[model samples]
Target: AQSVTQLDSQVPVFEEAPVELRCNYSSSVSVYLFWYVQYPNQGLQLLLKYLSGSTLVKGINGFEAEFNKSQTSFHLRKPSVHISDTAEYFCAVSPTARQLTFGSGTQLTVLP
Candidate 1:
């Protein structure tokens, strides 16, 4: 079984500020980790992924995440956020079950 948890339900950040969204997962076996972002009234888009190799993976829109196996965590970070970056972010994990388990999501509200 695999489960994902997003520590924060909502994050408020000022424009051009840095932000970090914490995510944690638990699985019995190896898994692929990912971060996705969804804009208002839109679908989800892949932000970053961690399948193997480097723990620090970069993604679109200046987003990045580090895969920490020991801590079972994959936290997403952005050096600078804009008002357009306001969206709902999700952390997902794919275990052997052939389905992706997603976190509750963290809503990012970038205030100008």
Candidate 2:
């Protein structure tokens, strides 16, 4: 199965702090990358995707990631985080179907 795994179940950071959401994946042929964020009691929103080209990809809300083929991983990073950034981050892989195989889930808490 084309799947992705997020190592961190939860990440806690103070307001204006930096944070990272780690993600790894395993696929046979090819796959599409996606990062979704979910606020409290809300549906997931597409944060970013890495379809092709440059390994380093930038996303919304000052977030970015680098696709490392050798490491078989794609990790999200933010320089300075805000309280609004507090939410659940999910790493997904789209192999063939539109349905994305999501990670367990990660709760990012930004304290004020």
- Best by lDDT, which number? 1
Clashing pairs in 1: none
Candidate 2, which segments miss by more than 4 Å at Cα? none
lDDT of 1 by residue, 21-52 (tens): 99999999999999999999999999999999
lDDT of 2: 0.89
lDDT of 2 by residue, 6-111 (tens): 9999999998888989999998858888889999999999888999999889989989988998887989999999989999999988877677899887899999
Top candidate, metric TM-score: 1
